[model samples]
Structures are given as structure tokens and as C-alpha cells.
Target chain A: MRSVILSITAVLLALLIGAGILLLSGASPIAAYSALVHGAFGDAQAWQRTLEKSTPLVFSGLAVAFAFKAGLFNIGAQGQLLLGAIIAAAVGFGVEGLPAVVHAPLALLAGAAAGAVFAAIAGALKVYTGAHEVITTIMLNYIAINLTDYLANGPWKDTSPGNIVARTPRILDTAALPTWGPVPSGFVLSIVLAAIIYWLLWKTTFGFEIRTVGQNRHAARYAGIRVARTVILTMLISGLFAGLGGAVETQGVVGRYQPGFNVGLGFEGITIALLAKTHPFGVIPAALLVGAMKAGSSQMQFVADVPKEIIDVIQALILFFIAADFLLRRLLRLKAEAGEERLVLSTGWGSGE
Target chain B: MNPWRTLWHYNRGKVLAAAALVVFVVWAYTRDPQIVEAVLASSLRLSIPLILGALCGLIGERSGVINIGIEGQMLLAAFVAFLVNVYTGNLLLATLSGMLVGAVLGFFLAFMSVTLRIDQIIGGTVINMLAFGLTGYFYQVGLVTKGKFAPIPIPGLADIPILGAMFFRNPPLTYLTLLLIFVVQFWLFYTPWGLRTRAVGEHPRAADTVGIDVYKMRYLNVTLAGSLAGLAGAYLTLEAVGSFERAMTNGQGFVALAVMIFGRWNPILAWGAALLFGFATALQTQLQFMNAAQIPASLLWLKQIPHQFIGMLPYLLTIIVLAGVGGRTRPPAAVGQPYVKE
Candidate 1:
């Protein structure tokens, strides 16, 4: 409950800071903000776009949150997601003569599996060699970017007439994720997955092991848990979630794998995870909030003649406030509650030894 | 006792590096005699920012602060420096402005890690996001600079065969970075200040037990180190590219961290690592050029490789090097841990 309040305050404070930036830049804060709000929530179309944006964020947020539960920082979600999107596209377009039910599920599973395998590389490196995941994951992201770019432009280039862009061939109609009225099926899947993850974290024995390892690896080892196995499995599962996000994006919205279209979907997962305070269920609301901002940004730019990047600035400010909660607590005069569990994202480098 | 075997046993990294250099020289000479000088000169040119970024990381980590925000610092500094150059047409002022921005950012990181006790990684992420957003927000399309800094050839030295061309014929920042490599090497090992910084990083509690102020040492070192990263940023806009692009620092800052680990946090060794990585980058570009032209029969198959795969070479090499060396190197004992006075 207290965390909820803190998150709310952080958002408000971030908005205030954002307004100050607008004012200093000689723009009317009121006009810009009103346009932003109207653009995000004014119509059903706006809400639909928000939900579409939120779907990927939910998966990516869960990926980061799940890893955080194991005391690992999965900064390579971008890479994992890229591989997922491309593999899904490969299965979606290349494999012909399949029914809708079979093709869609196959593509999704293939993408998620690719993501899992990619993430496992870093996890195995951490366990066997004590190589820091933070560094390895970041390097993996660049590799994924280049590898995917090569696949799209070289082997899988859309060789159809007049297609010069670096992107894969469009998925078959049967493989595309369906939209029910105004709501996307992929968004529904994300919400259901979030619920399942919450249950898994709170109720399962494996989840107990993950939490224990996160809290103290030495204690977890003493208690007869295989800490190394838990770390690797956690990463694999985390990658699966992020990969699913990319799969959904390609099947639901993009209809194909394109480089620039999925640029920062994975990085935004970090912001959403932190904003949700690493809570599985909390990810939904946090993703929706960020999604709304993203949805409205273009309209805000059009209406107020302000740059769309202001949304990113506001989002960063919100993360800053949440990460440095003491500043917010001091301003609000809130007392620290006893036995509050602080978020521990990682131990320092070489701690794997 | 064989002298060569004894040297290998005592200094394995140096021996391996020398062997690699010998192989590279042989290969380049075989390809084309002039290729050696061209590749070496380009390698050194490409390594300027990387060497500076590694030095920045070296100083901060030696004082017990993990500066993952180096990328953000460089990006922001590059943007500010580019804007200054565009308006003032003075390269010196633009470079100083970039350094100032970096110093301020370093101070902010110090406050978060040392005073507020926020997680250092999270703090760095915040800085990165803020820099990316701010630069993108204010950047005007098609803003041009007057010109970039011209290379200054040292008269006598630049004319002295291939070796001189590799080292002497370079822009102002490249020369400064080369001199800084030796200066930092000496300062880190021979100065009393270096001793205190190491003490703070290794055993802050022990340093605190004596008269040394741990917080002060950290703040000073991190801020000063930030200026080096800022210098790297200035080099990007004012010296190297002569313009700013959003997130232009790319992953070089992170690569610097990998280089730092590969060098085992030593300044001189880090220079060697930066050069090796820089050589990989140079080779990739050269391979692309060869792919475009009519290549020799021996290397004809190289043309079949796609360009994107060539771009992946440096990043993949970083992962391989880190996996090989990460376990062997030890970081500062108290690095990444916020110090609290009892």
C-alpha cells in the first residue's frame, strides 16, 4: 500500500518537473499537458493504441521483474526480444500450408524458445565463468542487433517488387494474432500471463527458491537449493517472457519483423519494472501508464508543437524519483516502515565467485 | 633457464600481446606493405575516445565508484559540445563545455552513490535515459558546425617512416590522449594521491580508521574521472566526427568497461586493449572496403560475408574477451559498495 502511494507521488512529481521543462522551453505547459491527456484517453481508438503499446511493455516488464527476483539484471532484453521477433517472423512467413491455430502457436513458441536460448548463454556464462551478466547482456544486445539486421537484409530480404527496406516478409493471414472488436488478443494474453506470473512468484516452490536465492545466495545454498540452477532457470524464464513480447508485437501489430519498429520496446521494460517496484501484477498498471504517454506523445507534438521526446524525459524523471525514494520521502515527511523489503537488483561484479 | 620462458611466466599478457602484434604485422605486410601503416594509424585514431573512456572508468573504479553512467556522460557532453561549436565557432570553448557537463554529471553520480546511497547501476540508467531524452528533445535538424579540428603533424617525427605516421600524424585530441595514457599511468602508480584513491577503493573502512576521508576521496576522483569521459565526448564532436548525433557514443562506453576488465584496471594495459579493439574496428572497415573493390584471389571469399556481420565483430570480440578474462581479474574490494561511517 505504501509503495502504491510512493509510485503515485513519483509520477506526479515527474509530471511537475516535465511541466517546468516545457515552461522553460517557452511552451505553455497547460496546453501541452491537456493535449497529451486528451490524446491518450479521449476516444476508444486512443485507448486501443494504449493497450497495444502496453502489451509489449507487460512482457518486457515481467522479464526484468522475474530476473530481479533472482538478483539478476537482464539488460539484454532488447537482444532477446530482437531474436524472438525475427524467429517468429521466420516461422510465420517461411512455414507454409499450416492452419491458423497451428501456425500462430508455432511461431510464438519458436520466438520464445529463441529468446530463452539466447538468455541462457549469459546465465551459463555467469554460473560457470563468473562473467558478469550486466556486461555480457549489454554486449549481446549489439550482437543481436547486427545479427538480426543481417538476417533481414541478406537472407530474408523482402524480395517483392519495390521493397527496398531492411525487413522480413509479412506473416501469413492465418498466423496474424486476432483482434476482438476493439481489444487485441495479444493484450489479453499479456494480462493473463501477468496473473499467472504473480501466482507463480507467490505460491510455487520454485518461486520460493528464486526469492531465497535473491535474498541471499549463501543462505539459499546452505538450505540445499542449487543456486546456480536457479539462476540459469530464472534467466531462461525471463527471456521467454521478453521473447513472447516480441512475438506478440510481430503477430499483432507489426505483421513482420522490422528493425526500427521495435527499437526501444525492450529497454522500456526496465522503466516499467522499476516503476512497478518489480511487482508482477503491478506491471500492468505501470505499463499502461507508460503506454498512454507513448500513445499520446505524437498527438501532443502535433497539437502543441513540442517534441515527442518530452515523454521520455518525463518517464526518466519518474524513474529517478522512484529509485531515489528518500528524496520523495523527505518531501512527503513519510516515515520508513519497519521490515520493509528493499529492492536488490544485483550484487557487484565478481560476486559470483 | 630460458629468458623467454621466464618472461612469459612473469608477464603472460604482455607476451601474448607481443605475439599477436607480430602476427598482425606479418599478415598486413603480406597483404600489402602500406596496409600495415594505414591500419595502424586508423587503429590509433579510433582508439582515442576508447582510451580516454577507459581512463575515466579506471579512476572512478580505483576510488570505489562503478561508473556505468559513462555512456550517458559522453552523450550529453557531445551534444553540449556540438551546440557550443555551432554557436561560438570556437573549438576550445566547446571542448571545455563538454568537460564541464561531464564533471557536473559525475558530481551527480557521486551524490547518488555516496550520499543518497541509491543503487549505482540504477543511478547510471537514469542518467542514460535523461541524456538520451534531453538530447533528442532539443536537437534541431540540420544544424551544422563551422568545421572540425584539423590534424597537426609534428614536422620531424611525422616524416620519419611508417612508425612516425602511426603515432605522430593525428588531431590535437589524439595526441593529448596518447600523452594522458603515460601521465595517468605514472600518477596512478607513483603519486601519494593514487595511494589514497586505491586505499579508498580497496578498504574504505581501513582508510576511514586512519585520517583519510573516504567520501572526499571518492567524490574527488569520480568528478575528475568524469572530465576524462567528457574529454572523450569532446573528441567525438569537436575532433572526430565534427557533429553530434543522438546516442553517438553508442556502446563504446560499455566497451571501455570490458577493456578495463581485460586490462585488469591498469592504465597502460587498458591502452593496449583499446588499441586491439580499435584494430578490430579498423579491420572490419577495411574488410568492407575490400569487399567493394576487386580483392586479391587469396581473400576473394571475404566478399561473400554480409556488412552487418562485419559490424558485429567488435561486440562479439568483447564478449569473448570478457568471458576469457573476467574471472582472472579482481575488481576493487570495496567497489560498488556505498561506504557508511560507523
Candidate 2:
């Protein structure tokens, strides 16, 4: 319970600091925030878009958090997401005549599998050899970006007589994921998937092994767990989630894949996962908050002409405070309450294991 | 046998990388002889910037820093170098400004990550993001409003045999890249300061016990990396193009990082990897002349081959190589650990 208080306190402090920065930048903080709120959730339509945006963030954030739980920093979510989107789009476009029920899930499966394979490249290297994932994953992102760009530009290009942008042909209608009114069916699926991920992380034996591996590899090995296998598997699962996010983006919202349209969605998952303190369940609200901020940015620009850079400043400040969280704890004179396990996991870089 | 164990047992990544290299050479031959010559030459020429960029990675990481903001550092250098070049038209002045900006960025990163003990990754990310945003904004507001910079090739040097015909013929800025690689290599292996830098990287606490200022050395190396990375950007604008374009470094910073790893974190090895990446890139561009070839005909995937996979090759191969020869060496012990001095 006290952990909840800590998180909420962090959120409030971040908002306050963000507000202070906005005021200094000469924007009417109150009005700008009001516009931000209105833009994100003032209407039914806005709520739908916010939920839509949150769907991808949920999966991607969880993808990153899952890896953290298993003691790897899987920075290739962007690449995984790209491979997922590309393969899913390929299936969605290439396969015709399948029934709607079979088609949507099949495309989704293909996307997830592609992302898994792509992600496995990094995992396999890390496990079998001794490559640092942080480097490979970042490199893979460039490959994914360029590969996706090339495919969209060339062979798989929309080729619609009038089109020029690097993107895929629209997925067939039968392949599209259905929606419930303005709220997407995919969002509900994402929520359910989040619960499942939480279960797999906290309740299951495999989850126990994974967290054990993350906590300390040598200790887990002593307990008869295979450290390398767990690390690779965790990365594979992480890739699957990111892939699912991309699949949802295609079937639920965009309807087609366009290179460069989505720049920081996967990388932003890092921020969301971190802000959530690597909690699977906590990722929901954290992703939603970020989703709302992103969704509202354009409207914020429209209403206030306050450069969107202010949001980045707010985010950086929040991350700064979170990284130096001890400062806040000291400043607030908060006693260290027992049993609040705050974000304990190994980064590939620093942890002794 | 399990694939993982098998991979560990045999360690085929380097063997695979070598095979890939042989295959590429063969493919180059199968294309037009003239085109292959030009492509090889072009690839070697292209290797210059990437070598320098990789060197930047080498300096910082060897001494326990990961400079993800190499892109931003490059951008700042390119932008500032362009401005200085427009006013003075002197290549030396342009290069100095670039190195200066990069050093400042590097120092700033080291201060935050080493001194304040911020999450080095986050600190690096902020630097990258800040660099992108700052440069992007200024290029739009200031440079475009002001004017553009022009490229200046060195006199007669570009006309000499082989070296002059290929490298010197292009631009004076290009040679700076080659010089930096050798200089960094020398500094790392020869200098007493280099030995101390390595000492701090291997085990900062131990170095501290031995009376070396770990924080100070890290700061110095990281800042030096920033300046070199910045010079890479200056070369991009002043030598390659006349003006700074938005996000023009275009992931080269990350590529340099891959080169750093592929180079096994040695400056010379980094230069070798940079050259390979450059060659692959040049081949991709040069292969356009062979569009009508019998080979490129069968493998249209070959067209997307180098562009997509070449970009991805280092990353994919890094894992491959590591698996093949796991633990031949290791990153510095204190790499990425924020030093919050007690």
C-alpha cells in the first residue's frame, strides 16, 4: 500500500515540476493543461483515441518490463514491433479467402511469430555467445527501420496508382480486428493479455524461475534453473508482446503500415516500463498516462502554440526524479517502510550476476 | 545436442562473418569488373566517417562510458562546423569548432552520468534526444534563415596517385577521420594516460584504491569521445554536404557503436569494422549499375540485401560473432555503472 503512495507521490511531483517548467516557458500552465485534458479525454471521441493509443503502449511497455523481470534490457522493441507489423501486413494482404475469424488471429499470430524470430536473433546471440543485448537490440532497430522502409518503398509498396509514401497496401477488411463501438476490441484484448502477463510473471513456476534468474543468476543456477535458457526465453516472450502491439496497430487503427509514421512508440515503452517500476499490472496506468500525453500533444499545440518540446522536458524531469528517487524520499522525510519491493531487477550492464 | 550448447561449443560467429565477407567479395566480382573496382574504391572511401564515428565509441566505452548521444554530438559538430565554415571558409577552423562542441557535449554527459551518478543509459538517451531536438530546431530556425555552408576540397592533394586519386581527391575533412583512428589507437596503447584510463575502466574502485581519480579519468575520456564524435558530424556537413539537414546523421552513431563492438573495443579493430560497413554501404549503392546482371536477377532480395541487412548485418553478426567466440574479451568491469562518489 505504501508502494502505491510512493508511485502516486512521484506522479504528483512530476506533474508539479512539469507545470513549473511550462509556466517558465511562458505558456499559461492552467490553460495549457486544461487544453491537454480536454484534448485527451474531454469527449467520447477523444476517449476512444486515448484508448486506441494506450493499446500499443500497454503491450510494448509490458514487453520491456517482462525482459527487465528476467534481467535483460531488450531495447529492440522497435525492431520487434516492425517485424511484427511487416509480417502481419504481409499475411493480411497476401492471404485472401480466409474467413474473418481465422484471418484476424492468423495475421496476429504471424506478426507475433515474426517479432519473436527477429528478437530471438539478439537473445540467441546473448545466450549462446556473450554479446550484450543492449548493443544488438539498438543495432537491430536500425535494420528493422531500414528493412521496413525498403519493403514499404519497393516490392510490398502500396503501388496504388496515386501513392508515393513508403507503406504497405491496406490489409483486407476480413483481417481487421473488430471494435466495440468507438472503443476497440483490441484494447480489451490488450487488458486481458496484461493480466495474463502479470500472472505468468508472478504466479507461475516459469515466472518464478524468470524472476529468480533476474534477481540473481548464480543463485537461480544453484536452485537448478538454466540461466541462459531463461534469459533467451524472456527475450522471446518480450518480443512477442511487442509484435502483438504492432499487429493491433495494423488491425485496429492504422489499417496499413507506413514507415516513419511511428517513431518513438517502442522506445517510449522504456520510459513507461521504468515509470511503472517494472510492474506488469502497473504498466496499465503508466502507459495510459503516456498515451494520453502523446494523444493530446497535437491538440496542445493547436490550443497553446506551446512547443511540444515542453512535454519532453516534463518527461526528462520525471525520469530524472525517478532515477534519483532517493532525493525525493529524503526531501519528503519518508521512512523506509518494510516489504515494499521497489523495482528489483538486473540490467545487463551493472548487476554482478 | 541443444543449439545453444552447440553454438557455445563451436563458436561459429567469426567464421560466419568471415564467410560473409568472402561471399561479398565473390558477388562484387560477379558484377561488372569496372563497377566492382569503383564499388570497392567507393566502399573504402565511405569507410572514413564510420571509422571516426566508431573511434568515438571506443574512447568512451573503453573507459566505462556508453555514448548513445554520438548522433547528437555528430549533429552539433556538423551544425556548428557549417556555421563557422560559412564565415571563415577555413577547414581547420571548422574542424576545431566541431571538436570543441563535441568535447563540451561529452563533458556534460560525463558530469551527469559520472558525477551526479544518473542512470548512464538515461543520461545518454537524454543527451541523444536533446541533441536531436536542439539541432533540429536550430537548423530550421537559424541556419535555413541565415544561409548554407559549402564543401571545400584540398588543393592538388585530391589528384595524387591511388591515395590522392581516391581519398585526397574528395575533401580535406575525410583525412581527419583516418588521422583520428590512428591517434586514438596510439593514445590507448602507448600513452601513460591511456594506461590510467584502462586502469579506471577495468576496475574503478581498484583504481581509486591505487589513488587514481576514477571520476576524473572517466570525465576526460568521455568528453574526448564527445569531441571526436562531433568532428564526425563536422565532416558530414563541411566535407560531405554543405548544410546540416534534420536528423542527417541518420543512425550512423548507432552504427559506430556496432563498429566499436565489432572492433572488439580496440580503436584499430573499430576502424576495420567501420571500413567493412562502409564497403557494404558503397556496394549497395554501386550495385545499381548491375541492375541488369544475371545474379542480381535471381536474388531481388539481394537488392534489399545490403540496404536492410547491411544496416542490420553488424547487429546480427555481433550476436553471431559473440556466440562463436564468447568471452574472448569483455567490456570494462565498471562500464555503465554510475560513479556516485562517497
Residue B158, model 2: Cα distance from true site in angstroms: 4.7
lDDT tens readout by residue for model 1, B146-223 = 799999889999976666768888988888899998888778777889888889999999999987999999899899
lDDT of 2 by residue, A1-353 (tens): 54556666766777787677677757788887777888899898888888888888898999998888877787889889988888888889889999999999999999898888888888877776666677678877877887898888888999889997888999999899987877788888878988998899888999999998877777999999988788888999999999988888888888888886557778778767877878888888988888888777778879987666555555555555665556667777777677544443214442224
TM-score, cand. 2 vs. native: 0.84
Backbone clash pairs for candidate 1 read: none
**DockQ of predicted candidate 1:** 0.64
Q: Which structure among the candidates has the greatest lDDT?
A: 1
Model 2 chain B weakest lDDT span, ten residues long: B144-153
Q: Give me the runs in candidate 2 sitting further than 4 Å from their true place.
A: A1-32, A159-161, A307-313, A334-353, B1-45, B76-101, B133-159, B289-327, B339-342
Candidate 1 residues lying further than 4 Å off, grouped into runs, are B1-10, B19-31, B291-297
